[model samples]
Target chain A: MKNNTKIRKSHGSGGQQSHDLLENVFIPHFRNSYLSDLEDSAVLEGWNGNIAFTTDSYVVDPLQFPGGDIGKLAVSGTINDLAVRGAKPLYLTAGFILEEGLEISVLDNIVRSMAETSKQSGVKIVAGDTKVVSRGSADKLFINTAGIGSVPENLKLGAKYIEPGDEIIINGNIGDHGLAVLLAREDFGLITDIESDVNPLSSLIRKVLDADVKLHAMRDPTRGGLASTLNEIAQLRSVDMYIDEDHIPISDTVESVCQLLGLDPFSIANEGKALFFVAPDDCGRLLQILGSQPLGVHAARIGTVRAGNGQVVLNTRIGGNRLIDMPLGELLPRIC
Target chain B: MKAEIQKIVDEIHTECGEEPIRLMEVCGTHTMAIHRYGLRSMLPSNLQLVSGPGCPVCVTPIHFIDAVLQLATRDDTVICTFGDLIRVPGSSASLESEKMNGHQVRVVYSPVDALRMAIRDKHLHYIFIGVGFETTAPAVAAVIEMARENKVTNFSVACAHKTMPEALKRLAADRQIQIQGLICPGHVSAIIGIQAYEWLAKHHNIACVVSGFDPGDILVSVLMLCRQIKRNECVAGIQYDRVVKAIGNTKALALMHRVFEPCDSEWRGLGMIPASGLAIKSGFRRFDALYRFPVKVKKSPTPSGCICGDILKGIKTPLQCGLFAKECRPDSPIGACMVSSEGTCAAFFKYQVVKSCA
Candidate 1:
């Protein structure tokens, strides 16, 4: 392994030398299950049914952005991962890698934000871990979270079950998360009030699952956004996909930011949105179920699976068609 | 919009006779747009589309990559670069691969990140890999201005910056290349203005159209260029009128002029072109790495039989390269053209160019 010592020192005070800024911020806010108070592990009660587990690391620079912070990001990111996997998140285990010399107050604020987000997400922080390095070792803060949730019975969802003729649906707009972070960095001087839609999708997924909707596959559009997610789905099912660009939901603010940055919103990242591969007959019901939720107001039936050799084609609003390929490399790096 | 675009394509198909006319889009975004829109399928075999050296990262020489690798290898040096340049392979390896070998390579969204790195590391030297056209050069120049104002001595930029008009002129002048028309970059045009392209039309007698990244914009630009070729007229046309203006962004241009002065810069394929690269003005020379480090590194030659130079000039296609696909894939790129997503070879490889034989 490379020497972590030199890397640790560069993270100065303004840099916030905390590895898990989320834990440092949230532990004090939620006194009920402040895992920081405990020494080793968080004690939790066993669940009765099938459980879902997911882990994610957040390293978005300018830790705090338009809509959320690293604390909220860590919670929402992990929650969304399990939520799309058809799980009702019950607990989250947060691990923080703090760089030395991080301000105690910023850590408090991050923890506080995490507590509020956990409350909003309806999940408790039951267990957590923390490690400190000399400043330069990590970014101001890096959050790693593992979450567990109870899976409902008779709910079978995965790419393997996806079949031809299924409709692909996106919960809302894409690229808000990526654009929000980009704007927050103030790198380009282009400014907008667009905040990251970094909220947990568990509640929305729960609504859909409760409606008894049949989902062949469900994935959160995170790092690589909608393009990569759909490409993965198409490749996994050995089927082709046809999406209409006009039908896809995109905020005007998001579109403007993308234009300014010379970035494609389809390829940008999103934390609050999920793409679902549902049976054609079940799409209407799923849309209705999704529409009932606050996060699913912009839900859309963007595309359908076709008979082909696993290609993803996007039909533009102007009647031209283009292939949406998987993102080759890092577009927005360290984004959850 | 689809009907209009299709109608234009049909008209071009009918106008161009049995002999095909080759049109090269010199913008990276245009290449990506053509590939993404599957525009290749819509165009008649009579019209051929090729990608040019509009991609700054793609045209950046291997020596620059090696220089960056050298900088990254230094414990006190933090090499900051745009996201696209990270994966571009040099002679030995790419910065991404070098990062795996314990190099301090960080993919930054903006030059400000490099400035921030410099501020964070007081003792270490922070060198921002300054790369791109006029669209990006202004922001980098601004960062340099900011560093100078703040008296941040640790910060310096390794400028591999290039200008578009000169490169286009050089390509058109090369007798080996037969570029009939040019699809200029919308982003770069928006910064430098359409007025800058008059040289291409005036000197090279080539049809130039500033096009947008959108599929509709590209289709319209192609139609415009075909009309110019048919009318035997050479002029700069604007298809991306939504954002790009004839005069361009004056404020951005002023900012660029304030900090950077035009210099003879070397391109990976086209060699040294006059007034092609941007160097920090004498007043801002403190932020330049060349002035600070004073290293006399020998310029390395392109990989043998790479043919990237010829391909960049639009004289040959990626298929002409012996290593293309067989030995030089995106994962193991042997040339700068294959390494960058915007490079002609990379575009051809990514889109799987369908060669047409007479």
Candidate 2:
């Protein structure tokens, strides 16, 4: 209720303080018909098809980063997860775990960002919960989001439909999200204005789905970037993926940053990007549809699917081939 | 392929006729670049490229890691190190595992960052694990100087830094691998200069060419070495001359000399080489963590069937190691070579190895 007040354990006790905090903060931003009811569950009335559901948690260090923050990232990530499966995202549930000393203003900013993103993506925040813990018990704040989407009965997409002639296309440049967050940490004594490409991909994916192309499979390259996603698909379907190093879109800034840190751009994290496997005949049409959108301006066909043992290969810039293995553990900067 | 690079490759193949030429690249970055770019696939079959004792983490003796682990366990100490060394196994555990046990083990980009932390938190003794070659030693030396100037008594470095020339000499003397040419490290040459490698060429009759980390730079360096071998001229040349000077960076060399001196150091692959390791000077002895916190380090045996030692010495390839991709991998590394990202085994596993258990 007061300006600049820090979070306290009593705020999460479900007492009067909790009521005041929720009424003053979350409700106004996320006010909707289902949420206004204040029921234990928001029973919806429009379920005539298969449902796609996903949940993800945000614990990024430096809660606010270039371009987007944890709140926006959490919403975009879960929505993209469902969208990649060709689902129309409908509703989301947010749960917040606040550290005792986190500032109220910071919490407000994050919540506002989440509400804005969900609204822009045509999704509703229908249910939520909040809890505050003692300092040091958790990082400043952690947000967990669960999303529900409707899958059309006529539309189907999966790795099982992939074949040797399928083509791999990406939405845009890679490594922006990871590099942006790394630079935001400001520990490397390096300066850059690179921003995270964290955005809800439901609209972009919806356009692609409406274009009526032969979409075999789709994956949002989030934590493991495009490399791991492709490898996962390749291994899952027992097909080989051969991507050209030059064709995979990468911004100059991201490329230079990854080079300075001795990191592979393919293995870095991306938030707003998705990979589409399409029939070779419809690859150009898919690219055209993707390129027409602001989010997919840099769309490019990176590689092709091959019938072989499960493997992902990259043709280097110098006309040589190398394997794209799943990145091991933590990505650490090289010593020298 | 670019026509220019293809021309160089053609020249290398032509020059390296029936004779088998073995070239060793002594920098970890070079080792990673070679495999990352698939340069070996571009080279002629007769031309073999082997990795030398390049990776600082791969070449660091396990005893040094054990010593750091002992220091990391102390309540009064906070270990700061490059990210590469955090996962290196000691006799029993790693710094990463120790930190998971609630000890303070921080990954710092530079030694000076640790000094900055020491200045802020005066209560904890920050022991920076100094593990690098000449390319990194100057930065470590500069940080120690800054610590001394700022009068930060709690900051110290556990030095395990190694020099390249001596290790190269040890490799050159070995009769097993028969290394005929060398692709000298680009960054190390920038610090120590082209003159440092002259002896290996002049005395040992081995062709040497300092190279940058780019795929083109490496191929050009290889072509230069092949030309030198064709002419029977054994001397050090520089292909990365834009950054590396003939005499190296004198200011860095002088700063390094002022703060440290050459001492006998233990290398993981090569046995003890005299004057191959850098030790803090007596005047700056107060900043040596080994001097401040004395921890007993009993030598531990290398992992069974890990040919990392032989691999580092150019005596064997990662493919020859029994545990290379089967048991030892980047995810669950059993040897030092598989731990560091720039390590030979790690590079081969990540880039070259195609078959996977899946």
Candidate 3:
């Protein structure tokens, strides 16, 4: 196929056209033996503790934005989901839904992005499928990735382990990805240098795990953001938690955009951030380990857990406290 | 800044000693800010900050939403609205539910964007859901003027725009909630001016402060309100001095006056207030969605057993409502109060519903 060729329904019809499209477009980028075979599924040899599996689909508007796109988001989002659970992600399956009139070059760009992310994260796109819909049936492209990982037998991490006096630590800044995508859409016509913090957390999580700190719980603050993740954990464990508003790292640019748009940074999504609950004694060491990694440079101890009914609070900057309710529906811009 | 806020808070605590004061913040932004900063938790027990009906989405009647839904589902029409209106329940459905059902409902940040869309797609009639107070009405008015100037025949506004003073006058006359003070909306005052709130102070003896949407600003306003109440003074003052002026933005006001006029409007919680809503002027009748695309709208009441009415009146709080967090939640909102992020119930749910640590 030529570089300027547009995708058609026949390309996903599982015929010679499908084979040619896959061979020319995807196989070269994700050229591993398992995927190169073009079999029904990738057969893995025996290895393992408990299996960790997760899946996520990306339908971010604009498809391309500052720092990341839908393709990069798809790969990292799935990988991060597994990593946050103390799992070593090893394999991923990519499924593409291409709108009929989409340009092949656009698909190639996104596929290449996915391949690069997979390579960097030490995960392989071992199995894949593609389906094309008629014009207006779907967006330009949507990528769904399901990841398989191995969790160590001795690793125990969950909300049940969360207790009073435990410290809550988060990696880097919050509200980057959601705001970046929103700004890229140009619906608000506001320009900013903020970029999406969309990257895999496997390396950072691996470092923390290797250090062997007293990890109680871990979560990747994705769609509903840090507030939702914190609230969910608090509810599950029936423990109360409060994070200081002054301590949560937020970029000046991100802060301004959120303020101008009437959005709460705690509730806005972050693609590449994680929350860790650790014993108070191990808090210093965890910070040290997190600071050493490039992705965790801005990591800080945000809050502490307490014994109470399930509630997540924010200690305001001016020596006051308020509850951080779990965000609901979409985070819409306030009109008044 | 934190130190200064503490000083003001301390002053407020000292001035209103043991004197029961019920103050209301008459802006949605103020409602959110008051909760966002946890001011209620910090304030003395003698002072109560109640939420008023300042949220445009919360105050927008259900029949207005039903009419918009009708326009949205029509094949020949496209409905453009702010994001806040998407999830708000109408009589039977919402804009969100209709959008999922494959309707042409779009969320635009400004009215001009909708006008531009209508200009671009001349084949489809675009109806912008003009909801908001004085702060937002000027932009809609300006966009309507732009459409007429450009001769954009396909664009119109289903105007639900409302003025602030009429609602305040109605609230002041209510015998149920004896509100002693008010934190007037800063942005609305920027459009309509501080004089608009003078009636509440002079006629009703309510201490009013046009407040900015900041923790420090709100704290200062609280201090000012406490001072006014202590001195036995009833007057309207401006705490958000930088943005709002005594006369306000005359250009925007002039533009608004040219495109729209005062008309009786229905509010969800507050009921009908005479001349509280803006209707497109007779000259711009061609750009009025109500006149252009007439739809039969059935009378729709507020949801059953929802206390958003009493909540809006400041006679009741969300905790007093039976359906607050149980049947009515932010996820599946049974009333407009829970649906709008700026709604008082939503603010409480998001930042103040939990037990106070103080």
Q: Estimate the Cα RMSD of every predicted model relative to the unseen true structure.
A: 6.9, 2.8, 2.9
Task: Please report the interface RMSD of model 2 to 1 decimal.
Answer: 3.7
Write model 1 residue lDDT over B224-321, tens digit each, in one string. Answer: 88888888798999999999999999999999999999999888888889999898899988888878776544678777878888787777888878
- In candidate 1, how many Å is residue A301 off? 1.1
Which candidate model has the greater DockQ, 2 or 3?
A: 3
Candidate 2 wrongly placed segments (more than 4 Å): A1-4, A332-336, B353-358
TM-score of chain B of each: 0.93, 0.97, 0.98
Model 2, range B301-340, lDDT digits (tens) per residue? Answer: 8889988888888888888888988899887788878889
Q: Where does candidate 3 chain B have its weakest 10-residue lDDT segment?
A: B349-358
Model 1 DockQ (Cα-based): 0.15
The alpha-carbon RMSD over the true interface for every model, in angstroms, is 5.1, 3.7, 1.7
TM-score of chain B of 2: 0.97
Assess each model's interface with DockQ, reporting 2 decimals per model.
0.15, 0.51, 0.62
Q: Which whole-number lDDT from 0 to 100 does residue B115 have in model 2?
A: 95
Top candidate (lDDT)? 3
Question: Which ranges of candidate 3 are over 4 A from the true structure?
Answer: A1-4, A37-40, A45-48, A133-137, A332-336
In the predicted model 2, the residue pairs found to clash are none
Candidate No. with top TM-score: 2
Best-to-worst order by TM-score is: 2, 3, 1
